[model samples]
Target: MTAVTDQDHTDQAGDAGSENREGPVEEPVGGDADRGGKDGHTRVESAKGGPARAEAGPGRARAEAGPARGETVENAEGQADADSAGGWDDGLIARRVTAETEQAAAVEVRGPNAPPAAPLAYDAPLHSRLDALRELVGLSRARLDSRTLAEAGQVLDEAAARRRLSGQHTVVAIAGATGSGKSQLFNALAGVAISETGVRRPTTAAPIACSWSDGSASLIERLGIPPRLRRRPLQSAESEAQLRGLVLVDLPDHDSAAVQHREHVDRILALVDAVIWVVDPEKYADAMLHERYLRPMAGHAEVMFVVLNQIDRLPGEAAEQVLDDLRRLLDEDGIALGEYGESGATVLALSALTGDGIGELREALGQFVAERGAPARRIAADVDAAAWRLRPVYATGRRTGLSEEARDDFAARLADAVGATAAGEAAERAWLRNANRACGTPWLRLWRWYQDRREPPTGRLPLRAHPEEEATARQRVEQAVRTLADRASAGLPAPWAQAVREAAVRGSQGLPEALDELTARAGLPPGRPPRPGWWPAAVLAQASMTLLQIVGGLWLVGQIVGVMAPNLGVPVLLMVAGIIGGPLVEWSCRMAARGPARRYGVEAERRLREAASGCGRARVLDPVAAELLRYREVREQYSRVVGV
Candidate 1:
């Protein structure tokens, strides 16, 4: 382990000189090393993106890759040792961060000379927040924009890697523009010349890590810092003891002319737990600093420390004026400022050159590190920022999925499309036609039958669209589907609304044909139209009248032939009575059949209407409702992620 002493200025300068002579020997892991990690662990790879051998310690050999899947390693005690090479499993940090008091009863074995481990603060709420985000993405990935869902997943993955590496250590980066004295402040905090400071523009090209305690290798490695660039502060001062879990980083100038340097700064800033933004009097209000970084990261005020470096350069009263102006600028950038123990950004003035106000800054940092909550707070702020960005996509005022009025209107439209009304009217007319045939005058019936032999009277009653209506039936059905979709998606967010419409369209693929088939099946009856109970009596009466007419005609014929004499014109009277009675009986039967025929037609209309309405509800309306329901469920999951 590399350690510095309070009385080792010469050795510190010598160490810095050796690092410069070796050129930039610290190579970042992987090509895009600053992308954080995947699966809750940092991606440790060689410079060429391949696995490389690593030195774990003086006597122990380490492999970049772990054991093969399902392979186990045993320690000297013949016990299973899963953390032999990687030191700990990926889930170890997660379990430690989220474990409750009840689980603390389990015992852990330690080496004879190993010191007792620090107690971990339980942050189950933060873990729960990450879980909520994961669930939300899983449920809404298809319904939402792919970019939004990807961003949410990135947040979860970043959180997992960070917490797994070191939940107790708070990684704080000192960042600023060129010639902003940030490197000077970093060295002063370390009490050694760890980061080189000079007048050259963008003196720091990459981040340097100075951890106050041991056991920070995993965290430093996760930050993409090479082993050679890692340093240790003097472990002799009581003031330094309070900062045991602090990992201070010196970042390159954010506004550097070199694109690669600026990229490095941005990537490192994204993964750090907190930031101590160092600004000077000359460039304290630079537009690049505020517009590019501070304004965009306003939600992270809880983990920000805005320090005005080089206060010694400003005149006595000018320093105060400049500090006040900086505060105003930060406020305009939407960063809340806190005084000492509040929940906002800490704004203060210090001079690394004169060591003025450095004591106050150290005290504040010590208190912050002692709390052991910076990791959780930074993760929470990240979640807040992501949730706010997605607010417009998932928010809505509508609680109900489908309205009753809209459903009824869709059913009515389907009934009309199936021609329910016209079918009922046709059935009523068919009943009348059949009744007329059964009870009309006998001579008229015979004439109709004779006429029917030449040209048959066609009487087939079935519910179906007219020849002209076939073309527009599908169009009417599609309109009903669109109407239901619109009703279900009202006031919904854009993504979910589109989803509902899509579901409606998908369910409507074969609906028109199905509805046509339904009506066809409902239209067929077993036999001819049902006959009323009084039909037989009417037939008998008609037969009797016909007999009388025949008798009268024969008597008249006999009288005219002089074979027998007629009595008091009885033959003529009988013929007249038979003709009038036959017509009267037909009229009475027609009137009686009207009421029953009308009822049957109405009943047929009701049944067909119900059948058409049911078909529509099953195909179109149900899918739309399901989409709405899925949106509601995902929205609630998003709310839980936001902790609302």
Candidate 2:
């Protein structure tokens, strides 16, 4: 923010820049500084501090200041210079006019070196962002692989810690390969001697933190920066006030020979809210940088900055060419460019040693600090990255459960294997046995009783299913479950499909025994239907017929003996009636048993089948159903995690 007084012109940018720096920040970092050859062109990749050294290029040091490369930066610098002139005094005409001429302000936001600053962040709040990250981690644990789960958990913890300790503070880390002058860039950005900058092979063994406010102590501690290396905000001048609440971290070199140094860089890279990757012109196109870090962090483009440090070495056109090439590499890395770009990776050119682009970098950082959305954006990016990592877990879409027809077929197969039909037949036969005892003709029933005495049927069901059937029943049940699992997990990922299969078999272990037990306890249909009124009549007629026969026999005997009056005609008629009625009544009772017995057989079979079905459902279908339910739950969880 620039202070404005009665003077029509305001020098807000100058005021901020002046407080931070009296002149450009300068320091020497270890490495060959030759950046180009005769044509002022150098290969995209220049080996730095290595055995192979390239010859020096013409005017390499100041070549980048040529017209072509300085087109944009020079214009900015020129405007700032013009703005720094004594004062703006325009002739005033005191007259009423419909329109007034006004000149637009050419705000020199950054110095000649850094790129233009971007707009403030437009993301959710820090807590919400961290909360979202935690939610993603929880979901991943249930539905994703171990690697994804661990990554999400780590990100969640780090993000929460950073947010808890630093309220509305932006943590911008300076990361680069060895000899990239990353430390120098860090110090330049702070406009103070905060980080150790030297020509040593590995100058920074540990991360150095420079804060612009006292609020960052806890934040720096959370970031794992030792208190010894921690520097308080520079309050000696008012310029640094613009950078208050900013925590600038100088990380160990990513390409350091020491494994510990590289590990430190990796650890710090993950925790920082934002990162400014310092790339020297020599190693600008290093594959290790792009492949290992930039490509993987494509989702975090918004909070990333790719700075081409030491641009002072390239000719004007050569510098432009290098920047263009760097942009190409970053694009290949899938990193985006600006807030307005589809991605969020900001690209710029600067020389930390010369401080040519330090003002621009500072301006950009100032805007970033002012935005106060770095934490939110960073956490959001992490969540997105986590989601992408677990993409394969849910690549396949959700499929509904097995069809009703398929299930019925499976059930029918199970019933057959369980001997449901056999049980029903036995029940029907049992019903018939009872029916006959209740309604059969008395004489014939006595005959049946005598026959049963010769060979009585066992009390146990005559139609009982054989125990040998248990094997076939178990096999059929297992097959049915397997089929159901296959269909349910058709398009699912391998792990989830395997889960469904395991779930299907969970209830199948003791199934055969259970079915056997069920069959053993299966109830047969009860017998003894209510007797009809005609049964009693029939019995009485049969008894009376017998008495009539006896009378005929006695009459005939008396006639022959001449002891009483002879009655041949009446006796004959009675005898004929008794014989015919007896036979007819017996026949009628036998015929009545036919229809009732048939019906009883059908009803008994139905009951037996029902019992068999119950066993099949509990032992077979129940387990399969459980698996399907689990599948549905997991599918829903993945859907939530991926937002699909």
Candidate 3:
């Protein structure tokens, strides 16, 4: 066998440019050596000036070979051996190898200098993305409160089992007024003497839970009852099988002499998934139970059973009439039954002593459990209703939902009502006048020149209007605001409307006091004194003389001085007696007027803001609180259904 030599060659000179231009160079095959000259391969003679080195056959020596040529061949062979040992010397080879390995391995490259290949981009459907966002929002909402999340989880679990029938159960409660034989009825239902029946009006002071089988021990535990407090199961296979998941409760009389017994009855009724209202024929139409319990519980239409216990005492036709009247009363309370024949609310005639209709009642309860499959669906419906009720509470609308035109109109009307327009104009004129008075001679001259360039008022100036006159204007503005608020709250519910009204009253009552306080705090001057009626006659005489001065100068001036001197001198002397009178008067008036005006404006704005806030509280926050309560009730019902 022949051993094959693996030879590699690397050219150092001119290699950089060649590698840059042509990339990696391909090694020539063994058969192409003789045709290299024809294929443009270059050759050089040795320095000893002999013929170029020629290839010899294997194990053969070349004749007439110079020492330099021999040495050159040996040098070339040594270099070739060194190059073969090193493999490729180009940095590009390393980079290319790295790139190829990365590409083969399917790793992504992101840099601009990285290899040109399309990048991976994820594109999801709109609905799927929206669903993900909805799920995230739902999770965040669920985690807002630990109690709320726990309740919701319980409700969801119960809802998942809504359609199943095997694990279904009923919660028939023996409830009645005092001395109505509820305990005896409970004993009759259980087919055993579990409940203590006595001659007293309220024999059962506390509730007793009696199951047909011991399988309800866990359920009894969930009711927070100890083994000592619970009753033993009866020994009957048929009864046990029929009452597999049933939880028959014997409650204390609702109209007991002891208030605690009545409270216990009320509490247990709320917690139970279903109710068996055991009423005597005489007290079947009792107003206390009908109004307080039955009417309020109209929402629980699905899980209610009305039983006319002790039916043997009533006359044959009277019992039917009493049941009919009871049904009518329930219908008026918004408790809708499916029909007279097949209704959610079943009115049964039973005598605990005679055992009449006891088996039929048991069969009815069993059938109901088998068909309705437990209170899971009803509990889910309750939760769904609660969720729907809560939906409006957290509802938000776009701030710009109200039209721009409507908003602008409202703002304009509000400004007009609050005297904002008149106040702004008055402020501008007052500011200008005060500023002109405060300015030096140069600025005063410039102001006068500017004023002269503009047209003078053709009507009365606003400052000449009476102080009381502005109050009337302000009153008009306040009235408008009140009207607007009233109108805005018109469509709200009764409680919210009342809240808006209450808030408005509070705002109105507070506005004036706030304004007065602001006025008292301001450091401003007093207002002008009241003028006498004779001042008009005096002003007429002075004006007539002043006009004469312009017509007849010297003589008119002397006469005017003589008449005006005494009164004018007296006032001027009093004012100029080491008193800075002008500034004090101006300061007093500004202090009195500006403070109240600013406060009134601020208060009005505050009232409007408060009114808006109150509206939001009534229409949004309060509703949310109510909805949360409703949700809590639904959650409790769901927990009961799921046996949590």
Give the lDDT ranking, best first: 1, 2, 3
For model 1 the TM-score comes to 0.75
Runs of candidate 2 with Cα error greater than 4 angstroms are: 1-148, 232-238, 339-343, 391-395, 400-410, 429-467, 484-496, 525-631, 634-638
- Of the two candidates 2 and 3, the one with more favorable lDDT, higher being better, is 2
- Model 1: worst 10 consecutive residues (lDDT sum): 102-111
Model 2 Cα lDDT, one tens digit per residue, 359-424: 888887888788887877787788778767765664565555667876777667666766667655
Clashing pairs in 2: 36-57, 63-315, 111-359, 111-360, 113-356, 113-357, 114-357, 301-344, 301-345, 302-344
How well does candidate 1 score on lDDT at residue 433? 65
Off by over 4 Å in 1: 1-124, 339-342, 397-400, 438-467, 532-591
**Strongest candidate by TM-score:** 1
How well does candidate 1 match the true structure, expressed as C-alpha RMSD?
13.5
Model 3 scores worst on lDDT over the 10 consecutive residues at: 100-109
Scanning candidate 2 in windows of ten residues, the lowest lDDT window is 69-78
Q: Pairing residues by index, what is the TM-score of model 3? A: 0.44
User: What tens-digit string does per-residue lDDT give for candidate 1 at 1-644?
Assistant: 11111112122223223212222122211112111123111112222212333222242222233222212111110122332333333221111111111110000111123232343343777778788888888988778768877768878888877756766678899999999999889867866445767676767776778777544556777778864455555334563577778989898889999897788788888888899999999999899899999999998998999999999988879999999999999999999888655689999999998889888899889988888788788889888888888888888866657878899899888888888888787777778767877888888788877876896343435444376687687788889999888889888988889999999999899988899888877763655688899999998888888877888888888898887786638988888878888988889989998998898788778877888988887888888888888888888888888997
Model 3, span 549-632: residue lDDT tens: 333443334446784333444444443431343334334444544444455435434544344334333433344334334334
Predicted structure 3: lDDT: 0.46
